[model samples]
Target: MRAGGFLIPVLLVLAGCKPEPEAPALALHPVPVQQRLPAQVSAPALESGRVSIRGDDALADVLSWTLPEASIEQPARARAAARRALAKGDLFETAESAIPLLLALRKAQPDNAQDARLLEKARAALLAQAWIALDAGEDLASLRYAQRHGTVLRTLWPALPEAKTYLDAVDRAGQAFELCVGGERALHAGNLDTSGGALELFRRAQALWPLQTRAQRGIAAVQAALLAGAQAQAAEGDFEGAYAELSRAGRVRSDAEAIATARQRIEATRTDRIRRLGDEGLMALADPAGLQIARERLAEILRIALPGSGAGVALRQRIDLVGHYGLFRPGQVFTDEMADGGRGPALSVLPRGGFSMGAPEDEEGASPDEQPQHPVRFERGFAMTRHEITVGQFRRFVTATGATPRATQRGHSLAYDARSGNFLRGSGIDWQSGYDGRPAGEDMPVIHVTARDAEAYAAWLSEQTGVHYRLPSEAEFEYALRAGGQTLYPWGVGAPPAGAGNLAGGKDVSTRGRSWSNAFPGYGDGWWGPAPVGRFAANAYGLYDMVGNVSEWVADCWHRGYRRAPSNGQAWVNPGCRTRMYRGSSWASAPAQARSAWRASGGVDATNARVGFRLVRQL
Candidate 1:
């Protein structure tokens, strides 16, 4: 307990609660005692002494207890009687006890070694008892017992050296206990750093008693408090306050391992939180209506993220692109609703990155036009139709706008002929016709459309959806076809994997029971003609049929090689060029034509059953 812990109510006794009406107003203590003034701060006492109500009653209590005097008695009788009392365990606090009786006998026979031995033995017993009481605990009763008896021993046995040494040891233990008590109170009140405050008191106690458990635990508690405060501040978005608390904790520990562990824990916790928020925001971009939530998540990231946080940067970019086409993540599939309740083709958001635009020169099955492999990168991401445009989707464009498709105007389009085992021009074949020039199913990919017819369809759909829609650039087409890989085929090297797409296969038996002479040895996709769009497994970017089914037209004009190709992945157009480039393998394409880098071109007005097109929306 510190000094002045309790206030002894005094002064203005007449104002006190009624005790006696006629008698003079009385004090609570019945006499004067030193008291602190109102509102005064209590000073921490190193050792708070026992308080007394300085009055006649207190004085009389102390005055009443007197020290026993050694009585004179015959030496022989005293020795016999003292021995009997010692054997009965009666040592002190009575005249009949052993110590006073020995003292009486020692005065009479100072030269007697037997009497001297008895006196010394009684003193040692008292000292040992005192040590047992003190060792029990630092509670008030134990402490008071130790201190009160120490004073008695030194006063009564003034000539004994051991008494003084034992007393000194007891005093040091008492001091250490008192210091920690004061420190604990100060810690609870948050007075940790003030002069003579908790930290100082704890250190002082440790110095006094090197192995004191109280002091050791107190220091650890202080450090824990500091670290907890730092975490709370960071949670509240107060980085300055959080760092300040961490710095304070560092001072308390200051060891390299401790500091590094503390910092790593804080950063790991924060990084995990930032990463979760970034992932949630990125997911929100997969839904166009979730753009608002994505923006909100990004705002939170900016507020709490550390400088140069990668999660924060990623979230910000995703938020920026969310408003474009209702925000889809890379490889995420989505679609837009047109004005007349018709939805555009399902599209997959393409990842923005660099890739080798054409096949490497030394690759197997490499073509002369695919030589000089060059780099191409898209600065901004774009969304590509997840599958080729289906016949049902194109029919909507034709039904809405009264436009004559090129194949319909020419009255002929090239189509597969089972008897000839080749594509041959036939009348009555148009965008509505199947590979065999029969009426195509709605789900089958639209074929036999010229490049201009495909472009016109994209333009009509753009007006319907209020967004930019066009054919993908040749570089974009190749990069997306590879889909984050550099491989000989879209699905990787060697023979095509099973069900890779509707590609030419050695096992395939056509309607005329004929298979290609040169085809993938063991691959079969279970299809003889163009299957429904997205019938096969999607590529890495969630796009389907980029290497098979039917080859598709791109925005780039025909080029001999990539020597003069655009590096930014934009369509390289030569004005008024009639020849246009188309890419990917057809269902009847040979193994060499199935290469990932394969390219071919035809007159813009040309139409064929083996060719189709898909569109991309600029983001």
Candidate 2:
């Protein structure tokens, strides 16, 4: 039967005429058509015929066959299909195929009301899909879908509320998402300055997306960072900086407990700092040199705005006291009597004032070393003994401390020899021995003591009285000697008045058969060697034996002249200095040598009957 079917087609082709066109072939099941066809029917010819037939009528047949029961010819069925696609979240297919088809059906079938309703339903489904994209956080996709189909839907159904509503929702979602992203970025960067702006963004985000958690957490993180930064600033002692950070945090979330705690810590730290500064100022009151530092600290405390508090008031008062009266005022004299032996010197206060140290060049007997006289000032006042340290006081020091005088250790000292009329080193003479080789009286000024011995005695005195006792500076010694007088002698410009001081005179010739080669000639108090302490009348400043009796050791390294002397009455000490300056003159000194500005320098370790020292108490 298959052979007869092929032969009929061949016989028809064998006729010299074209055969009539038959219906296009289609299969409901797979068939071996290639094998069943005539050999003359080439594969290309078969394929061409199949394509032609599909173009003619198989297209509709294939679509009807592939589509599930719905046909484009039926508008209601097509609209239903689009709805199903939208429901399944197939936005692309709904926009590209279903929406266009529904629009065409609505245009063609205007009178059919059901077709118009189905068309409207399909457009609504597209609008819903756009909103769905928005809900899924696909901002670009949502915007794209809306832009693609929104215009058509709006034009077709002017009263469809969801068209406008969905678009508005998309805009709000976009803004909220943008704000949330910005806030999170700022929080992650730890930018406190920009954190406030970021928080504003988060707040706006919450306004848009009321149920969003990211915006809320972003705001909390920013506030926490600000509070933590404030705490760190407080720990570093920057209260103002901390307050600024805290204020920003407060703006973000005003009711946070951490903010309140940080504020409290800042207040407590400020108070403690003020208190510490007050204590430091009080401690500084003990020393005049520390007044500057105290003032600085107190000024800082005052700037912190501690109102009407006792601590602030006390600090101000203390600062004022220091400013007005200084740590120690001038003209305030006191005495320190030792508790153990009741053997300490009377002290007189000298204020911070200016003076011209050394004598004028034109002054009589003024040496070149005393030339170029310069001005000096004292910033801090000190208390000085009224008289030179006496043999009795030195003896007490030696007995208490067991300190041996340099001369005593050497077993001899510089003594004035009556036979030779010259100062000669004598055996068995020490501080206990007078310049004449006789035992010194208890009240006599200590002689034959080196500078080291004087320093040791001053040290012991300081330990005994719990005061700072030391030798006077050269300028200090001169200032005390002048006692506000401008004369050659503390008594006057001329030779010392009778009984004014124990100077070289007729008394020396009569007692020791030796006298100054050029003596005052008319002046003679009494003693030829060393006189008792305070035997001479006190100077204008109540200091005794300032110009005579014996030269006093001063705390200054010997300089060639007043070339580089201190403008202040402070000691010019040189480390390992071998020579020390001694002011005033000895009992055997000539009248010119006894002048106030007649200075002499000697070996620091040299022991002589002429050298002695007085003590000063630093206040």
Give me the candidate number with maximum lDDT.
1
Task: Please report how far candidate 1 places residue 164 from its true position, in Å.
Answer: 99
lDDT of 1 by residue, 1-619 (tens): 1122111211121122111111111111112222121245321332334222121232232223334575765678778877887877566667777788888887788899998898787777778766666565344445555655565575577445566555554555556666666766666565554588777877876765554566766665555566666666665556667678778767764556755766676676576556545544554454455578778887877777777655567567656655564355677777888999978889889987899878787888788798699888765577999889889989988888988899999899999898988889999999999999999999999998988888889878877886657788788789888999898888888988777999989888887888889889988887788989888888889899998999999987888988888776777777458999999999989999988899999999999988999998755
RMSD of each: 26.1, 33.7
Q: Each candidate: what lDDT?
A: 0.72, 0.66
Q: Candidate 2: misplaced stretches above 4 Å?
A: 1-333, 339-341, 506-508
lDDT of 2 by residue, 1-619 (tens): 0111122322232232211222233321121122111366421111111111111442233223221222357666666766566456443333335555555556667686776675566565677665555555423333334433433444445355665555444445444555665565554455433535667777876766554455666666666667666666665556677788889879876567867786887777777677556545544543567678778777777766446654456556665666554545566656787858695887777755667888888897788889788997765566789888888888998898888888889898888877877789999999898887789898888989988798888768866876557788888888888887666777776656677787887545545455567887666675777888988788766788887789999878889889888675667766458999999877878787877778889998898888888988755
lDDT of 2 at 198: 60
Q: Cα lDDT of model 2 overall?
A: 0.66
Clashing pairs in 2: none
* TM-scores for all predictions: 0.48, 0.48
